[model samples]
Each structure stands twice: as structure tokens, then as C-alpha cells.
Target: MTVPAPAADGLPTRVRIHEVGARDGLQNEKATVPTEVKAEFVRRLADAGLTTIEATSFVHPKWVPQLADAEALFPQVADLPVDLPVLVPNERGLDRALALGARRVAVFASATESFAKANLNRTVDEALAMFDPVVTRAKADGVQVRGYLSMCFGDPWEGPVPLPQVVRVCRALLDMGCDELSLGDTIGVATPGHVQALLTALNEAGVPTPALGVHFHDTYGQALANTLAALRHGVTTVDASAGGLGGCPYAKSATGNLATEDLVWMLRGLGIDTGVDLGRLVATSAWMADHLGRPSPSRTVRALSHKEQ
Candidate 1:
């Protein structure tokens, strides 16, 4: 296969999308998904050629009741042909993940104090401090760690988060031994200009775009536009959900992450290779949407489903 190089505009001809439908997507759902269904969801995603599938979170049931079955779900998808990273909020969550033999885990940190307090019940610095030990022990266990920095662009409580604050948190996470950073537009308020400006600032701050993954929410219908900006900056990793499946519980105004199928559609149009089969992916999302008892928010899935008539 001839790998295409970057375009004249500098967008890479290939991108690796991090699939977050199982953990991040289902976590926000009010109705509880059966443990078996959740496992099957992860299986379908891996079968669709998703290289990195976030299987489940080891968060407390009281906090996220939907993913309370993380321990149960992880065992089922652990052997898939992909990197199955589970979310670990603290030391305890990490313990559960490690005991289940998780080879890769994710720790989430917030850029804004309000989101930190709301989601983690700790101040920004306090939360990072809490994650420090988790990262440390995960390292000892030889588990790959992916750091998620939420509210990188905007926060519902604070609104319009500054770049420096985001940079500080991101740098701190990298300093704490996070293998990669996933910058999240939690409230989905970022435009392409904002995305570009932030990536530029992060690059200037010593964090390369290669180590950063752009996670956008399509709330304002800017997910694709902002994603183009990230691509133009040479970003390779993107966090997208199957069927556009989730929203932030803490950020009530937040919507779902960029749909994986939608991202693939744009990348393929730009002649970018994602190694994901768009038709199989859409069918997966459509099937998932049916299970959730709602039509998918993904335009690609909707358009294809409409055409099947």
C-alpha cells in the first residue's frame, strides 16, 4: 500500500482515530446497557478495524452507573486485536483495571477548576496530584497510559477557557508520564480558528501534535470543521464515538463526541487512509443506535441508512 504523504495544506494523508463508543459513549446514557450488550458493542467496534478502542471505565458505580460493569465488560474484550484502554479516575480505579490485566489505561484531568471539581470532586491541582500515583503505579505495572485533558477549549461553568491554563494541565500530564494527551473540547464550543490557535499554542508549549489527540464534540455542528483545523496542524490521533453516542454528565450543556463514521467520511474524501471500513462502521453504529432506541446523531450513518431504501 502506498502511504500518501501530507497534502500541500499540511494535513496528513493518514490518521488514526481512537474509538470511544463503549466507555465514553455509554457512560452518559441514563438507561443501563446490559454487560453482554456492552461487550458485544466493543467486539463490533474491533471487528470494524478500530485500532484503539476504549473498552470501559473503572469508575465507581455511584458516579457512572451505566459503566458500572467495567470489570465485567473488560474481560470479554481484552483479547481483541486492538489497544483496549480503560478509564481510571484514581488509584482505586487503576487497581481494578490492573487486576483485570489491562495493558493500557487512561487518566482524565480537567483544564478548568470548575470541571475538575464537578467531575473529580477535587481542585485542578488536587486532581492531578491524585492522578500522579495512578500514573506512577500504572508505569510500574507496565501499562500504557493515555491522558485526557478536558475543557481544553471551553467549559460550561467557566466558559471560554484560556490556552495557558490548558497548556499547564497538558504539560503536567505529560510530565506525569502519560504516553499521549487527548485534548477534549468538552462543551463543543470551539471553532476551527480556536482549534488551530490552541494546537499552535500547545505545539509552542513543547507538546507536539503527534503526542496529542483531538477530541471534539459536535454540539454546535463544528466538530468536523475543528477536526479539519487539527488535521491541518498535522494531528494523527482523533477521539470519536460510534453512532455519536455520548455527552458529558458534568458538562450538562455538552453534546456527543465527533462521530467516528463522520470522521472517516471526511478523511476518506480528503484521500486520507484510516483503515476503517465506513460501510461496516455505519452498520455498527446503526445497530448500536437501534439498541439505544434512538437514531444516530451521525450524518454519515443517517445518509447511508436513508440510501439503503
Candidate 2:
């Protein structure tokens, strides 16, 4: 696939692709991947030049059985030359990550009430409140915190999420010491116009574009287009999973994330730097697809891998 050249003005010259295949990608898989495979996936993602890789979630095994081996999986990739940030659902999870010498962590909250209760068993406000102490304690220990706000565009239970509600959640996360906020289109219902509008609202609400990351799901095949709109709006960080690996178990409409290989292909063609090697990324995703007993979902990987990926 070819991407049009980015306009000489307005678009960012560089973008950061936060690889999440190791964590978000596998978290919802029905089969429990071996810890070794999870570790190798992280290693391969880092080798593909993804500086920020979400290694694993520190949630309880009963909640996400796929990531049950988080403790073991993290150590296998700890010494890699990359920033590995694990997801800490609460204070206890934070303690577990800190015990393993984790330098960066992420906390998640939903922008809608239903998802908040379903995913975290709390109200929207209660969910944000749950993260406050976790964010504060992590920051005090010099650990970088990335806050995630899900259902930014559409919700499974509640139709369209209010723009102000999303902005308020984002602002609260920023104000509570999150180093970065990842806006999640959890249902993959966002379009370019919606992305631009939300970013505009965020800027108007005092959130720095630089401190934001866009997490898009490709359920409607619009993740890349939405991402382009975000780039034009000055959002430099994008969240992607290798081979389009991930979906929200709570939001059935949502599917895999934007594939890293696809994003890298577009970025390279646009003359934007991501510091990632497209060939290596495709190879890694193909390997992961092989492990999952299927072909990679990435169009670029399918085209270039040449082995029926």
C-alpha cells in the first residue's frame, strides 16, 4: 500500500509508535501463550526499532489468563535496549511491577460508565479515582505513567460518548501525574473528522498534543486514516500491535489494533521518520502469526512476507 506524501507543513516530521503486541495484543487471546513466547515477542518488537513496547499487564491472572505469567515474561525482556512499560491496574499491580524493577507503567480507565464497570468494576469517576494513588506513587518513585482512556469515540452500551466527558477524563489523568495519555477508540468507530475534533477539544482543554498518544482499533478499517488526521493535529505518539493483534473483550465491536507494519509502511512512504525497520517489523509479525496458527492481519506483512502471511 502506498501513502501520499504528507503536506510540507502542519504534519509532524516524526512519530513514535508504541508497540503493544506483547501486552494488549495478547491479553484477549483465548489461548494462554507461553511466557517464553511472550518474552520473545517483546524482544522481536524491540529489535524492530520500537523504543516503547508495552511488555505485559500486571493484572491478576484470574482477570486476564493470557497474561498470567507477567512476572516471568517481563524478566526475559528486562535487559533489552528499549523502554518496556507494563500495565498496572491498581496499587497492587504497581507494587508487582516495581518489585520487578519496572521503570514505566500504564493505568487504564474507561470514558463511559458501562465499560468502566464491566472492565474495572467501577464507575467512570470511581475508575479515575482508583488510578490517582497509583499514578502519584509511581511518579514519586520516578516511574513514568501512561494513562489510557478507553471508548473515546463510541461505546458499546452508550452510543456516542460525549466530547466533554472524554476531555474531562483526559485532563484529570494529566493533572494526576500521568506522563502521557493514550486516547483509545475502543470500539473502532472513530473517523478522521472525529479524531481531529477530539484533538482540537483536547488542545482547547489544556492538554498538550505532545503528551498524548492515539490508540486506534481497525474494526472499520479506518485506523490509519484516523491516525493521519491525528498526525496533522500534531499527535506524535501512536499505539499499535504487531500483526494487528488485540481486541476489547468487553466491546465486541472492536477488533485488532492498527498493525505496526502497516503504520510503518505509511510513515516511511510519507517521508516521516519512526526509527523502525519495516522489513524487520513485518518479519516479526509474520513469526507471531505463525505462533498463533494463522496469517498475519497486517496488509503490508501479507504483501511482503511472501509466504502466505
Error of 1 at 189 (Å): 0.6
Q: What is the lDDT of residue 151 in candidate 2?
A: 96
Clashes of 2: 0
Query: How well does candidate 2 score on lDDT at residue 11?
Result: 79
Q: How much lDDT does candidate 2 score?
A: 0.91
Runs of candidate 1 with Cα error greater than 4 angstroms are 1-9
RMSD of each: 2.3, 1.6
Q: Put down candidate 2 lDDT per residue, 109-227, tens digits, no spaces.
A: 88889999999999989988899999999999999999999999999899999899999999999999999999999999999999999999999999999999999999899999999
Query: TM-scores of all models?
Result: 0.96, 0.97
Please, what are the lDDT tens digits per residue for candidate 1 over residues 1-309? 223344445778779989999989999988999999899888988888889999999989998899888878888888887999999999999989999999999999999999999989899999999999999999988899999999999888788999999999999999999999999999999999999899999999999888999999999999999999888888999999998999898888888889998888888777788899787898999998999999999988999989986
lDDT of 1 at 292: 90
Q: For each of the candidates, give the backbone clash count.
A: 0, 0
